[model samples]
Target: MSTTTGLWLFRRLWKPAEGTPVKAVVVFLHGYGEYIDRYDAAASVFARSGIVFWGFDFEGHGRSDGERGFVTEAGFDAFTDDAEQALRLAARQFPGLPIFVMGHSLGGLVAVRLGARLAKAAEAVDAEAGAPLFGRIKGFLLSAPAIEVDPAVAQPHLVFIARVLGSCMPRIRLGGIPAGDLSNNATVNDHYSRDSMNNTRPFAARFASGVLAATEAVPGIAADFTWPLLGMQDEGDKTTVPGACERFVHTCGSPDAAFKLLRGRKHELFMADGYEDLITGTIMPWIEERCETAEPEAGGAAAAEAGLARDGMSGDRDDEAEPTDVDAVKTTTSEEPVLGAAV
Candidate 1:
């Protein structure tokens, strides 16, 4: 059973299905323009693991009070605050339970920053009271985080131009434009349109400002983060460039940061076929190990120890706990359509 509670004008929950215990909350963050409902299937998986799931609608997103597809400059910051409030409220509802934060795409970036902020805030409280401020989270899960701007195309100039132009014309409604303004393509997939969870309109001035703020802030989060972090990036990801994902894996400051490129998978790894099984069978087990057994290694411990280490990271062992050959996924050809399918 799951019960919903209101926090910051949004709904959150403690979902305990599939025999999950009363404790063990997993806070989920949906991607841009998307709502928590898209994660219903994922929540069920957590329930089966005896883990309660919690998630909410960002202000400009589902079920929250705000203009549809319109975001303000304080967008990301507000979302982060809402998430933190949800965590505190959840703690009150179910005390003494271990919590994990997981985010997808834009949400992934949010989780990384939020986790580090929580730690820092707690430190601030400890300095004054000589006691930890909040229950430390168990771990972090980032699936295809939208950390780096995609490099497949000439992005910097495009982004800069958009920012500059948007400043002059802040109220532009890009949703009706072909290829949705960002790509300028004609056949931008309909899934984005039908999935009301996503924000179909153009980025509001405030929201755009928040994105720049987030991008600038990512380095600080990466440098300060001290929790176990797992990143699952796709080799064939179309939304975020492979180059960016690779850089993020090494740049994230967590000693335990590890990203595996699912060979055949697309940007949305969670929604991909068979991924639920892979997560239940592989990733979750590793997260459990960190939560129950040891502190996550920082500065390239997990990757170096896993023997799959690459890109300037080096370690002597490959003790990553995985059934041999289970991590392999299929690869895609250059000719395949990148945006049409979900997976």
Candidate 2:
């Protein structure tokens, strides 16, 4: 886990018991040409609930180091400083517990910019208990959060000429995201084409302008997300943009934000096919009710059983106008969303 661009960053863990007393502490983030050991059975289902998973491998994905599926321009703006250096190394390797951040696709836009810079660095101070746990962060689940870019497959004129002509030859190459568009679940597209540290190719026009400036800065920081949020997507997710992650979890400013739905059109729902019902009925009851923050409503009852949009339920492919997701073997980037793979 060194860097200064000399690379190295590869860490991965999944301890469930070593001297028990675990109910929280996760920082998983795999997505966009994956790695972190393919979430080894979703970090053994949060180490069978004792929970203490981990992550890394984004300096150039998989076994870290750099080049495969590319990155640069500050290695794609240090994906939220390597997930806030794995959330301060999971609060110094799980000291006072209470941390949950389960990002998928583009690590759910860098865990919503490290949960809005640890919710404004836990509101300027008084993080209590020897201070600076950055307000202990007890939530954020998101799975398909590449926040906006499914214009029926990358069509804002191919995301405006792939970040305006790939920022003038910024490492060129281009094309990606078609391991069967990541999941119509043919055995998770044949185990993402027999793994091999899955990069699946073509990317690096400055990693497509760092995935279009880290997913176009997630809906302008969804009102500066105060933390505690749930996301889950795939209303025919052709990579990202499940109604731009249901309008950025209903424009989060978190009163415990929420939005759920991961129907058949999968985007690696931890290997699809009942994926243990998103882990024994929705992510261990939202990590055992946030192990301390007295959890209850990330829009409760599994987001009213995924009917979302509060209730007015809008579907018809969530049209607030459309046209994105692409790559005919090479069309710049944007989750390599091919036009036909409906999810």
Go through the candidates in order and give the C-alpha RMSD of each one to the true structure.
13.1, 18.9
lDDT of each: 0.56, 0.65
Deviation in angstroms for 294 in model 1?
12
lDDT assessment of candidate 1: 0.56
Clash tally for model 2: 8
Report the number of backbone clashes for model 1: 14
Please give each candidate's TM-score.
0.72, 0.32
Off by more than 4 A, model 2: 1-100, 112-120, 128-136, 139-167, 170-173, 181-184, 187-204, 208-267, 292-343
In order of listing, the candidates' clash counts read 14, 8
Worst lDDT 10-window in candidate 2: 299-308
Candidate 2 clashes between residue pairs 3 or more apart in a chain or in different chains:
151-323, 151-324, 152-324, 153-324, 153-325, 154-324, 154-325, 155-324
lDDT of 1 by residue, 315-340 (tens): 11111232222122212234432112
lDDT of 2 by residue, 1-343 (tens): 6666567777766666454446676788888777766666656666656676777667777666777766666746677787887778768866666778888888888888888877776777664742547556678888887866665666777777777656777777768787776665565577677766778878877777677766777767777786767677767777676667667766767766555566665677666655655665657776676575533211111111111122221101111211122211111124442122332
